[model samples]
Target: MGEFSKTVGEQGENLVSKFLDTIGWVGAQSGESIDCCKSEAHKNPGTNGRKTHGIDFFYSTKSQLQDYTLDNVVMSVKYTDKPYPSNPSTLFKAHLKDLAYTIECYMKSDFRTDNNDEHSMSGIKQANDTGVLFWFTNDKDSDQDVVGKVSTIQLEKSLSFSSIYLVDNSRAAFIYNVIKYVRDNFSEYSFYYHYTFSSANYKGADNERYGIVFPVEYLVSNILPFRLINKDTKKNVFCLASREQFSEESINRLLYLASDISQDFTDEFIFLFPEYDPLHDNKVLMKAKRLVNAKNRAPNIKVLAYNNDFRGLVNE
Candidate 1:
């Protein structure tokens, strides 16, 4: 655990592969030479290119438009800044030994599929395996020792992860400051935002697709974006998307300012429009669908349509 903590845990696994490429995960490298050794005998994808094995990210999330499949989301990334081993089963035995050989080679691969059009990969691998443990850290000041003995249901019923996204380190800078607040307010077209590993029971704002809330006036403005990113002092914020709302009462005043800070058990809400925020002539996605059909609707206060600057939809 040296070498600058393994390069800050490999840059916190490249910010967990850019937060799983903003959410729609799509082949985010590191199968470690195609599921690296277990005594040779690996390599899929036409004998070489397929890669993807136990963890360190190996994705796929598009069941339609251009179709996709492979996504058991096995993960493992730990970047420390010292102070954590105060005996919590010694950091859960090094996180179940880095997720027992990539979940024992993804439970002896096979993921069966005779092309029966696999049911939209239901809930991204129900229990077959869906691990995640980003857990980064700028260390706000101790106390984060592997999330103070956290336990995703005893580490997913004793490993083989079916769901575990402890992305710490102030939630990796509040999802990298909401993709740098849409790459600094749109900075000129080219957009694509996603950060959902599943969860959208909508209608009550309960779409845990990468859950979020962060109130406190998004850190006194300026760049809070909606606050809730304080890894001891990592600090997070939001609330600024006024470069030109267009009209129609400024898209109902940005959907009455996001339903005046919604919260139906908080699950999703990261509003920030600028890169040419056009709400007027009714088109900014029809003013975000009239602010999700205004009048106390708060349909998870989301306003997205196209033009995302995440560059042609996350490839890095």
Candidate 2:
């Protein structure tokens, strides 16, 4: 297992490096300047000695054209070897938080200077106004045919980032063109990946996302209502709880709470179950299905089996 793990890790890192090189090649072809940073200051050196930092490919332009500013293109490379778990919470929150922090710090520092002069700050300021492109790669296990996976991050949102995953090789050319567009036409917008958790939520995990505990009734009542508050929104709420905490009676009670809340605000309710073969002794899946199919259902309810490959839907 250790040897296999090492191979997986190295493969992931290699894919990320190649992706960065591709970005550099595309930037150079378009007459853009590129720099790659290798520093422990950008990475979180927690208990593990490993240090990782931002943008394996950092890019800037030599000439300005249209609204495109030459200083706005930046790219980061991330490599992950582990298989994505069935549930989002299964991934370590600390690791994700540190990654987000490193990116945030890198962006701020990339454009900051001590001189603060108009011309000097202009270059840094223009760069700050420009958005960053993040290329994320993960190596598949031996069973899978793909050598690597690629994804793009959009950093337009203030508190949250958005990402779209693409298959390897297929989108390589398109990725370069988009980077060029940001450099010349849209230097003011930042692009980032919208991971399951946001930087703020991850930083304040103990107080916000994973730390607080609520009664089963309170949890059911609040989740969908909070989602409904924004009509036309398709926000996903990821809940993590031990199956041991659920019972037929408790499940029915929670269903009742949901039904009551739905009367005030009507919306579709969909519950996703893990796709992998059953391993735990608990009957959480069975109970959840039963509750959703109950005769007293008020709002429309749909139950979906989970897909491991699906990227997270939650912005935070």
Candidate 3:
């Protein structure tokens, strides 16, 4: 991790600790929560060999506060400070898979089982409640990239829990905001918005440009309270995007909008399509005799092509 990333991680842990304290948890740690199973393992050595699980924090409720049983509640926390990947769809899929895994594990574990029923091998069917993904950040720079972007969406149709969470976070708030936004703003006219940008590339000129600025403008102009949510702390403003959008004219509209949003934002903007043959000409694909030539000069605009694998290029 970079210096900023390390600082963010530490800050995230501290914020989570504070959140737990607020909810009446006595002790909380940055890592997994394994308090419930620790003693059980000590009594049964064979249990030690099984997988270990943890909740982010463990605490006892005040006896007089309510009739709810303390053993019935388990809290799991996840921390993230990095801007979610630029690709929302892929990130949404991955997050959904993670939630499914967590649910599966919780269902199979002894963490929620009664001591007497432990031998029965039955699973608890009670609803497992999870705290919102907390976001923590000390960066107050208004020139931040995503200060006020918001998207309204609805879950009129049933979606996997993870997908639901993904939509919520994608809007830079906890799942609640996503649910609310959808409930209030969703209509037959509202279209789901998607943004795509290219990775930062060196400007042939000395402007030092990179990122997809085009769609970013659309995000800032349309979305309200443009900010990213940290499940650990809460939603806060954070810059997210690259600077490569200025390289092409066809997409320059997006770049202009992004530039209008924040002057301090600095990142390369990626184009959805890096290369394409508008004429279906095979000559464009042929090996060039020279990398650069006046006669066969490459087109200035980069379009988003269907086959352009953004992740693959980034990995390379």
Candidate 4:
């Protein structure tokens, strides 16, 4: 496949899109169904082939009222290897106009899609509260120094959001790429979900998506399994249950989650934490863990104190 001749920044946007989906963020396109971990190469379609101006990657709650999950994170992905000039003024102006348009749409309730799926003017309202996330490669150092100044410009102009962040890469972001990379390299690591096409119910339905989890049998047949890879070894031997709360029956559901996988996982290790009470329910968890492993389906179990925004903690 020939790669698109996109700018370094455009390439960065594509990378961020993939990262977003892996971390549970769905892409927001004008007239298409939102998908996770899907990448769209940039192509100039405007006057003189200028890159289109709008939300690079917009995410929200997966629930029915899928609105803006977070304010626009005008991504500034820098390529340490490229000789591109750092133009803060140009960057700020572009993002500000983008935010302005976004706010304008929200005010008119026009952000809602024709399918009424995502960014339905539910999560974001104003630009003052939206922050920008900057990503840099190893060589593009200096925090770009102008970031602080640009952020002030954003605050002064919008009076809405003034948050700024910089990261070479987050663990969650790392895991996001690793899963796909590994899935591509090995068929053993490959997994897929089977869902009948759906677009009607918005209760738990994602807009214009194929899978809606309708049939009871779909529980065991279609949903994708989380392949929690150990960062050190780059292996999915360890798994963590991220749910916050769990009742007695919930325990059975959790057990079946790991066991129901089509692939054999007798050697997998699963960890979880009770919702409100973080470190408190080992006895109960152990009982459930034992029941799951009783059939020689043996998978290690433990209670975890999951901290940070990173997905399934690496058991280092």
Candidate 5:
């Protein structure tokens, strides 16, 4: 790779590493070389044997919400200076194939065995290998949804691998903006990811109520619910960061949802949307508040806006 290409790649990897830190996927092993399983090496007809696969980043962690399960995530990052290609199916397919091959080799490689012993916790029954592809661009328009563009592509039946997740520019933007808003506005309070129905509710499960990592469900959730608490004053704030634009109906529903999930100790509720203008939304917001208060639901909820553009966090 040329110096320019290498620099762009490093930038993307650094951004992803910081994001992983925010979500509590820390201590990842990067730039690893894992020996290719013979099964994979034999499939290729090349004269010279390809003996190793490169892993951009790898992490293994016990699931906070899933009982007795560990998640091993393999990550691949691609950063470009141009907008997404007009026909992205070809590129998406190639990326997926490469990642799938990496996962296949990783599952059988000694690197995985050695790390599992180091990272796996007690009582874990099964470990799942997951692949995550972070494909992004630094173009003027960096908010394109790459997943939607490739959603229509049909995978070949012969192509087999574990679950894979794609983080397009837009998805990453939503997650980063949420982090920026919280850190900028509520830097003092303790952050906690709220447990939902998806969390293991059974006794003796590792369903930690306080953690920096988000349950996988929240990655695609319409609303990301979390909490903040000031230990000094016992002030508890429950928050929901929504992906959609501000809407009266959505606010009303989210208020009720927050009320249902929020603890009695919660002192306030904050709802974040992509954009909320008081000049146009104040009346509706007031009406929603009144209705909720009339029903004796959460009355302390307030609405605000957050940056949805991916580029907004360039300096962050």
Candidate 6:
């Protein structure tokens, strides 16, 4: 890579690492090389047998949503100064292949063994190694949905990685916007991940209700539920983030979810969507609120739109 390319790549890695910290994957191992377990299988075309594979970041965490499961995540970050190519399939496939190989070797490497030993818990029954590729671009068309474009690319059966998530600039922007909106608007409240049936079932007394760390599943989810608490008033507010644009159907479903999980002590409920407009969407929001109210007594529901300002990521 050229000097400019290298600089851009490093900046992307830093940005992604900081973002991961907010979602509870903190203190990851960054910029490390692990021994390649399958030298011949993963050999470069014209070079000697592969000796090492470079990893951008690696983190292991106990699943907050799944009972007794551990997640070992390997990440690859690709950032560019230009928009995504007119067609991003070939390049996306190559990136996935490389990440798959990394995971295959990482699963058998000593690094994983050491990490597993250190992070082991008594009730853990399963451990999954997954890869996440964050392909981002800073340009006029940074909103391009690379993940959607590459969704149909067929992968080689030889790739051993089970699950590889693609986070294009578009998806990254959605997540960043949701977090920034919460921080900026609800400054008095602290954020927490809402516990679902899977997580609540196996939670122990010492296991904190305030979830600072999230499971790998949240990275690809369309909706994120948050439980916010005010320090002084000791009041709880339930918030749901919907990545999809605002609509009556979406708001209705979110209402049902909030109603199902909400506690009696919840002070209020808020819904966030990317394309919500107060003037235009208020009618639909009121309709959805009434629909839910007919079945269950709904709380005061506030709707807001989050800004999709991904360009700010580069500045950070």
Residue-level lDDT of model 4, residues 57-147, one tens digit each, is 4433333223222233333334333322365556555545444433333322434333234445553322222323434443443334444
Compared with the true structure, what per-residue lDDT tens digits does model 5 show for residues 1-316?
Answer: 5999989999989988888888767788789988777555434465466677789988787776666777788989988988889888999998887788888888888987886786555777777788888888888676767778898898866655778888888888898788788877777788877766443635445566656777654665668888788757758888899988888788888887888777565748899888777768888989888887787564576777786354434323
Clashes of 2: 13
What are the per-model numbers of colliding residue pairs?
Answer: 20, 13, 52, 6, 0, 0
The alpha-carbon deviation from the true structure for residue 94 of candidate 2, after best TM-score superposition, in angstroms, is: 5.9
Candidate 6 C-alpha lDDT tens digits along 95-123: 88889999998888898888788766556
Of 4 and 5, the candidate ranking higher by TM-score? 5
| Better candidate by TM-score, 1 or 6 | 6
Estimate every model's Cα lDDT from 0 to 1: 0.44, 0.34, 0.33, 0.40, 0.78, 0.81
Task: Assess the local accuracy of residue 88 in candidate 5 as a C-alpha lDDT between 0 and 100.
Answer: 89
Q: Is candidate 2 or candidate 3 better by lDDT?
A: 2
Q: Which predicted model would earn the best TM-score?
A: 6
Q: How high a TM-score does candidate 3 get?
A: 0.31
How well does model 4 score by local distance difference test? Answer: 0.40
- On lDDT, the candidate that comes out on top is 6
Clash pairs, model 5 backbone: none
Comparing 3 and 6 on lDDT, the stronger one: 6
RMSD of 3: 20.4
The lDDT-based order of candidates, best leading, equals: 6, 5, 1, 4, 2, 3
TM-score for each model: 0.26, 0.30, 0.31, 0.35, 0.87, 0.91
Model 2 worst lDDT window (10 residues): 213-222
